[model samples]
Target: MRWIAHIIVNAVLLLALAGYFQSIHLSGIGAALVASFLLSVLNIVVKPVLILLTLPVTVLTFGLFLFVINAITLWLTSWLMGDLFTIDGFGAALFASLAISLFHMVIDAISNND
Candidate 1:
């Protein structure tokens, strides 16, 4: 149930990103759904390892490097998912990551019954 909720949140974030840019097309809701699922899996299974590997930089930057890690994770997600989840460039990936992070906060708040 928690995983399902996470995927739904990702789907919303992806849709939001699409709305932000006129060039990006999501194919359809189903493609967005698949992208969301893939993103969740990538974050869960791949993110921690990447974070740990970059822990030194994370600490050095006073945790700011986490954002970089997040962007990289999203970029890798785009690669893994290919056409379904396209990120046009680094700037797009960075903004998309930040947007998704903010969206996660919203989801967390709502899920916590706040």
Candidate 2:
């Protein structure tokens, strides 16, 4: 239930970001949905390993390096999504990741759920 809501929100966010940022291009809401799901899967399967592998950098940066990891996950999602979803470059990915993370933080804070 929560996951579904999260995915839907992420899709909406992706669409909004694409509209606001010239660097992002999403085919449509369907593409956004697919990209959102892909992101969720990668976060589950890849993000933790990335976190582990980059732990030293993460600690050194006072946890800020997690943003780069998030950007990498977004980049991977765009790569896997092919033409349907695209980010112009790593800078765009970083911006999108930061926006997504901020939105999620606010949502979690409001809902008081993990």
Candidate 3:
């Protein structure tokens, strides 16, 4: 259903990130899928709490701190997946998070139009 499509889009975005960044690596489509699923889960379960905890900092930064939160989530996903999904450093995770966010926004916009 819609959830499956969202996961597949996320996997595709992960593969695209791997193709664009030397520091980002995905073992295969399976790894990308797993990483995407884990990322989604973490975003759902951990992101809200993180945002709540960091609300003051996020407000001070004009909402830019959300990018840091996204990068942390990405790094966590890489850590959970171990070698299968690797982000070399915080820089790479930040860039990957930006790219993934952009792609997801575009995809969501397109889907919403239909």
- The top-ranked prediction according to TM-score is 2
Rank by TM-score (best first)? 2, 3, 1
User: Which residue pairs in candidate 3 collide?
Assistant: none
Task: Please write out the lDDT profile of model 1 over residues 32-109, one tens digit for every residue.
Answer: 888888777778888899889999999999988877778887787777776776778877777777878887888779
Per-candidate local distance difference test: 0.79, 0.97, 0.93
Model 1: pairs clashing at backbone N, Cα or C within 3 Å? none
lDDT of 3 by residue, 16-114 (tens): 889888999999999999999999999999999999999999999999999999999999999999999999999999988888888888987987899
- Higher-TM-score candidate of 2 and 3: 2
- What would the per-residue lDDT of candidate 2 be over residues 1-114, giving only the tens digit for each residue? 999999999999999999999999999999999999999999999999999999999999999999999999999999999999999999999999999999999998989964
Give the candidate order by descending lDDT: 2, 3, 1
Lowest lDDT sum, 10 consecutive residues, model 2, at 105-114
**C-alpha lDDT of residue 6 in model 3:** 80
Candidate 1 structure lDDT: 0.79
How far is 53's C-alpha from truth in model 2 (Å)?
Answer: 0.5
